[model samples]
Target: MGPAERSVLVAWSTFTTTFTATRAVTHWIRDGHGPASGGITVGGRHFHHYNIGIALLSAVGAVALRGQERHRRHPVTAMAYGAANALIVDELMLLLDLKDVYWAKDGRTSVDAAVGLIGVGGIYLAAAPFWHRAARELASTAVHRPA
Candidate 1:
């Protein structure tokens, strides 16, 4: 209903959509169905989406932290943050292991991580009000109690 809630909903939706789209596009490219059949090669090196994700994440973080409240709460900002988060999460395994294990059996970890994130994100969005109330109550009780 409010700006914060709307932003959260937008972010979650964007994250899920971007994650699905990224996976499909990447798979298509990997299967030699896209223009960049062997992946985007520059200077004889393969370019990975995670790299773009990192950059996008950095930019979003910067804007969120340093920009005005309106900028921070903008739908575009939320979308960017969500999309970047999805991209990074999608390749979490590669970042963790610092290896090109994508498409390998080990790459399954990336999908696992993405799914876990989606689950957790959904839970948070669904229960955030309850959690906020619980936190406030706990804090109030703690402050009033005789320690």
Candidate 2:
């Protein structure tokens, strides 16, 4: 494939890896909690607030991609906003699952997690390389703009 397609693929893969990591942590914490407090306590990391950094990183990538795409400027912040919201949604899912409020009669809750991870993860993954390109473009434009 071409550069753009490759970039997109890389971004998608990065986001997928990020989501899977976050989900794994969430699942581990939910399963490990037995005292009704329901939180991760491994190697001194709570891991309860698990989505913040990844979401922020994705947002930055989103902005960078927007910068590359729109030399005229765009609401790249919206991408970040959406990612933040998705993070919250994932957190909610984790909480509900931990509370035992999420599950089918057949003990199926992983499906829900998988679906959200794919949907939300896809957003940031697509945004990452796009943002990186946008940021580069923006920098070039800025340098020329001053000249």
Candidate 3:
């Protein structure tokens, strides 16, 4: 409806898309449905998705904070931030324990957290308009009501 609303919608959509896509790709790789070797491995150390995620996030942050107006609202920056965040959060358990437990029982926490984040984001986006309206009404009433 307005610039703020449009921005929120675009941001939420981008984040959700990136998050879902990242999770799906991670699942595929974990299930051996992706690359033949699961993922890139070098020197007996397997590279995790979050590694690239962190890099992308850092790049996005750098660009966004470069004092360039055009770069701040760039779709690419938003997308990269969302995707990077998804990748990092998808491996929350691994990051915490410093071990691969993607298929282990505790790994479910990562999935839960990701899903919860998505759900909360969606709810906030959907309710933002109402929230704005309610805030305005409350302020108006407070100002107009008897003191």
Best by lDDT: 1
Q: Give residue 10's error in model 3 in angstroms.
A: 3.5
What are the C-alpha RMSDs, in order, of all predicted structures?
A: 2.7, 12.0, 2.1
**Could you give candidate 3's per-residue lDDT for residues 1-147 as a string of tens digits?**
864455556666766787688767766776878554477787877888889889998998798678487776666666677778788888889999888887799988988988898899889988988998999999999999996
Could you estimate the TM-score for every candidate? 0.84, 0.36, 0.85
lDDT of each: 0.88, 0.53, 0.79
Report the C-alpha lDDT of model 1 over 34-133, residue by residue, as the tens digit: 6788778879999888888788889889987899989998999889888988888888888889998888999899998888888988999999999999
TM-score of 1: 0.84
lDDT of model number 2: 0.53
Output the lDDT of residue 41, model 1.
83
Model 1 alpha-carbon miss at residue 56, Å: 0.9
Model 3 residue runs over 4 Å out of place are 1-7
